[model samples]
Target: MIIADNETAIDYLYYETVAKTVVKLIRQKSKEPLTIGLHGDWGAGKSSTLLMIESAFKGQTDTLCVRFNGWLFEGYDDAKSVLIETIVAALLKERSGIAKVADKAWDVLKAVNWMKAARTAGSLAFTMATGIPGPDLIQGIGSIASKVISDPKAYLTGDVFNKVMDGAAEHFKEAAPSETTPQRMHAFREDFEELLERAKVDRLIVLIDDLDRCLPQTAIATLEAIRLFLFVPNAAFVIAADEGMIEYAVRNHFPDLPAATGPTSYARNYLEKLIQVPFRMPSLGASETLVYLTLLLYLASGVSDSSVEFKSLLEVARKALQRPWLGTGFDRDKIKARLGSIPSDLDAALQLAAEITPILTEGAHGNPRQIKRFVNTMALRVEIASERGFQDDIKQSVLAKLMLAERFAPELFNAIARDASADGSKTISILERKVTSKGGKDADDDPMADWPNIEWVKRWAAITPPLNGIDLRPYVFVSRDRRTSAGIGVAGGPVEAMIERLATSTLGITQVTKAEAAALTPEDANRVFQGLVTKIDQTEDLGKRPPAAEGLARLCGDRPELREPLVAFLGRLPVSKIGGWVVSGWGVAVEGPQAQEFAELVGEWATQTSNKPLSVVASLQLNPKSKRK
Candidate 1:
């Protein structure tokens, strides 16, 4: 089932508590305008919280809510203008009798446009004064002025335009202006508040979402416009973004900011002045993550968050989540009882989520999006496995365990895949016993020192009881995540299954023998060869070396076209990797002149390379000519 990634439900993230607090804060009556900063990392449910906040205003006549996404207009329009126009448009749409008020707001918004153009021209003049060629800056300012002048009446009649002309006339003068900057700012503020009063909107709450996703210029434009034109009594702005991103935008917006040269106190002070109230979203802990995972799994399993059963569970869990002292009512049994016999895959997912909650939460940095991505990835891997006829063979818990390794302990996971592919059936048996073995403290003292991969395997094996004796190469083969699929390792599609079959059974290599390799079409052979190269390139430890070597050897012996690439790739490997003996033994598999050619190739590699990889093999050669390197 495809999970919805966007915010649709109010309490899916159990954010109602925080949402209520925001609602309370926004709903309070105050004389001064307020800017509430909702700060959280991306996908930490900032948008969802915003949605809940919007919901809180439903059925209220006195408040008008306007939801705006700054990212949508990043390049299409000026963010400053879009935000101003949007609020005015929303207010006009709400009260049909307020068109005149919207017209006045529109005029003030037009004045904002004039103010921006004047500033741009001033900046261009400054750049020229500093001996910097600002032809492009000049051209951009001209282009903007042209667009504004295209609507001549709006641009010409604006007092802001008159103000700009007045300022330009006194460009180099020391005399004071008829109006100061603060007076102009106050004029726009008064105009906006009058529009709200005219519309009978007691409070205008503008919810700005995805400010973090916008470009630096756009983000700053939105924030600065709200501060300049919309900061008035009975008007509030809620900005949802990661504080770091906004701070980054701030740095980019004002590159010469005082904090840029020293400590960041100036930037913090700037942010504090703009965002009067800061509300940071709390990161999910272990128990909270578990509840979140269970809810997402329920949603992914075709159960809607609006369903009565899910809502009941969410209400109880949300209360418990709000107050830890209340104790959670969302244990596994409670979830199972509420969900009532879910699909086996979802059931397995639920169990897997609980088992790996701690590590997964920590590894994912307690981000809910990462957890959802993990679940989505696991489901995709299971679907891939099922497509390859291993539907009944792989279990969800087993898949989750392997994915945990792939996601969190990547080096250790790669080691397991490399070794397990070579040893096949015996690999799992050995690891199972290795973990269960009651070795004394000495065996455990440095389990991680000599071979950390082994220690990782032991710890992993001990997590769940059902992974014993299962040949895991197929799961590893099918669980090729695209993000980590680059470099040396398993890749997706038909070749992955082919490689799994070849590497799993070392007994006579019957699964993909010489005959089978010969029968493969050229396209299929190339794909398989490339896939093998990736695995061979990633094989690090010796215990994990044979599978890649054996698979490469078997394919090279059968496909004549693969020989040169194989030799070239092997030549690049260190002496410790594709050793002289391994190459010579593979030569035996090839037979005839190819064997002698392979030996000569090894001799050539040893001659040019200083490591002398073939020294031991050269010493055992009966022909004295072989030791020439």
Candidate 2:
């Protein structure tokens, strides 16, 4: 299922209640401007709540709602200037006839540009009107004069220098009449209020979202901009961010605060000064999560949330949830009536929601986006498997149940996968017998009685969509966790068994099956090395070529006695894999005598063919340390 990872069209979390409260607060006819902080952690639906507040002013002519996402315009030199320009432009766009307001807004932009130029010219700009150059200014002038005289053709009469001088002169002249920073900010406020009056807006609500995602500088700049609007009448600012993150930004931006008044104190004081009112979005509960998952699944199944019938059904669910005793259980018949015949996928999603809600709620820490992400990840896995003609034999619930174990009970799940890898049919037989056997004398005498200790494992084994008598290799393969790939159907043979042990074992330099590598005699090592070479040769994707070579390298790196075996392995390899390995840095793993022997083998092969590239790479790999010098 793929619901859009954005604000919900329906109020799944009842955040509209919070949004309404915010709208009511902003709508109040206060004499002074107000700042309300909508604080929540990342993905706690702060953006969605902001959207809901914007919706509250949809058709109202008296209230002008504007949203600014600080993260969208990040990396700018001055976030405060960007905010000032963007707000003025939006206001002018709303009412185009206000020429006086537009002119004043243009002056704000010009003043900001003048200040930027003044900063660039450095301390000399302070004495531009005194008609006497300071030492630094004289030094700058002398450097230019020397450059012009020393290289007249290269530097004299160059338009670039003249343009730079002209620009600096213009800024110096313009800045003499430019208003001070305080005077300009006051003027901006007056112009802003005039524009609001001209537009006939009773209240201006500015919703700033995603402030927490910005860096320290940008976050502080946005906060400072809000302080400018905090005193203007009939204006309100709602900033959505995590309070903790904002505090962290404050601490980082102002790092040199005195220890007695420290970063924490400054951060708290800054937050209090800016955000006078704070509202936090509560985390989702079990019932709420189930309903949310069901709705999301329904939407993903192509149901239109904006349809009158769907909205009515959603309202009914919301009303039922508000009742303490009735709970979140919706009337199935009513929903079915509105939706027509329920799609089987939707039906399954609803059922899966009921089964997985509690586990998902706990695992996700009551976060809605986390639950959505979990479902999206599962659906993508299933979709990809189906595309590859794999896992078509399994049901969705089986996948969900397996994922539950993988996500929440990781150790238990990995153990099950390993057990299946060691022996699939035998493991399945044992589990089936243990789960199905009646509690008689045989059950009491069962030797593996205490196995599978995790609560979720027991629950999984007992759930429907029975897994008895099935080879779990496909399920484990679909999981896509590389560590669990060992459990995915190993063909029985000494060579294959050796390969599995080598590939799955995490040890030695390459971290590949150390015990197996240590156990091999020269002859067995030769056979196993040939087996890895054969596997790499048969593999079509070159991406899968490195691990086998790495395993061989680690084997030889740890036990140099296997150098002769590595020679045989290298002699049999296709020149392409060798060249690819050498160029791709897999040669670095081949150390000691193994590196020398492998390089000699490649050198011999290169001589027998016309592959000059292989010859060059072989020489480099043989004397790899020469490149370091």
Candidate 3:
């Protein structure tokens, strides 16, 4: 039931409208060369939109469309050469029936090949004259030269050396000695334009995608190649990339350019000059996200996009998206009316979509790819629980609620996990109250006063099917893998050595070891602390105090600065998974100003309804006088 992350021709996000507009613009300006920039953030569906534009040009005999992904040619010596070659190849294939067109295409290809050879021959000359191989020499030879260039001695050997010299000589003999670079470039463009005229191509629309995924060098090179055909009649280029990345590439390619030589930045000017028409992909709004999610969930349920049922749903969703501010897109009645009847699975999917949309919208920032990923992850988790035989226990709404926290507010999620675990009850009592009731109350009067003052929390709390008394251990258990730990891993030397001693069993860590752990530099101590926290997080059972706990206690006892962080670490541990050993082990670690904080924590543990043993121990710790004689 996984939704694929690849770019598709599906008009799920209404990008087809944008594509159609772009195609119309190209047609209106088909007589002149046109360069259009399709700008969007990664995963914002730039690639998919490009596909829509290409699809729009299908069956237009007068117009030819060719697709090229710059990322595929990332490591090539010259991205410009490959791009030119690609366009020529596409032209040749398209006009294969015209014999004269083939000859003209071959001539253009020959010019590209000569340009490649010139680069190689120049590199060979530089290496022989300077007794040092240039970077261009290695790049010019391609994969075979790259492999042996590291060992210059091996590069000078028999067949490989002969091959390089022979290729350079052949290209040099065929090259036009009197032609300067600018003149050659002009001639190549003239030849290409003549070829287009001969082939009767009204407009050669080359769709360039994934330029943002390429290296700065490759990205800039591809843009440079497009500039060669910038003025050639009947040539139109539609480039899809993140504008920011391309700007960064421009800055990188020309490091000496001033930050701003005019009203616009240098990089901005470069892109503005090259890309005449720019279309920025819009981020999905809340209503659009809801409609998108519903359609995706339907697809996940085995509803094929090609089916009449799916098409009908898509039409409704598109209409709703057109005016999202009116209401949440596609209510149940509307769906049922359109489809005649809603399957139970689809009804459940709709319910789930509604349940998660509010938080998912804000969390995923309305990116289609991100929303799709979240859906895929949620569906996979449900399948996993079903396979593990606890499917019935894991409700979709509950899991969705927890996942919202997991994805957006990880610290909050960890806090909830600790609260749920404190008494082995698996329920979060802090969220039991209605969100609206918290308003107008004094800070001290509100139970949620201790929670972060973020708006998303309120929205999440107001979501239907409150988590109040629901046992969430099964859901939490299924989601353990998604948990993030604060540990930075072991820093080598004394810090690493200290972790080893502290990680040992109680009997293994002697008083001398505790003294050594306490004397560590604050930086080293924090590192050791983080390492221990990571170890405890990975430990399968919190039923007993982990061996690292004592070392953490001793380290914090000496370093008061770590007390707040230590309390935070303790607060994140699942209480239900822990045992009575946690109630009294801190000793002097919680002394001084932090003692009240620790005491308050213990008092909360004592009042929790879950984990009787832990509650009893915590209760006794707070009131030793009440202990049995």
Best by TM-score: 3
Prediction 2 TM-score vs. true: 0.63
Winner of 2 and 3 under lDDT: 3
TM-score of each: 0.65, 0.63, 0.70
Q: Between candidates 2 and 3, which one is better according to TM-score?
A: 3
Q: Highest lDDT, which number?
A: 3
Once superposed on the true structure, which residue ranges of model 1 sit more than 4 Å away at CA?
Answer: 119-181, 260-264, 325-327, 332-350, 387-389, 423-434, 437-459, 466-468, 483-629
**Model 2 — which ten-residue stretch has the worst lDDT?**
122-131
For residues 1-629, what per-residue lDDT tens digits would candidate 1 score against the true structure?
Answer: 55767775567556888888878887775455888998888888888888888888987888899999999888876677678878877887788765677666665655555455455443432121122324544333444355344553465456545545433322212212343344445666777777878888888888999998888888877886776644588888888998766765665565443432222334455677788889988888887888778777666656666777667767656756866534467665665576564456456556766787766776666778888888788777777877789888777777777777776554456556665666544444555666666443433334233442455455666677446567776677776555234223544345556765555447535677566777789998888787666655444443244565677778877887777556545544555445555445465345543444344444443343343545455444535576564
Instruction: Order the candidate numbers by lDDT, best to worst.
Output: 3, 1, 2
Q: Whole-model Cα lDDT per candidate?
A: 0.64, 0.62, 0.73
What TM-score quantifies how close candidate 3 is to the native fold?
0.70
Check candidate 1 and list the clashing pairs.
none
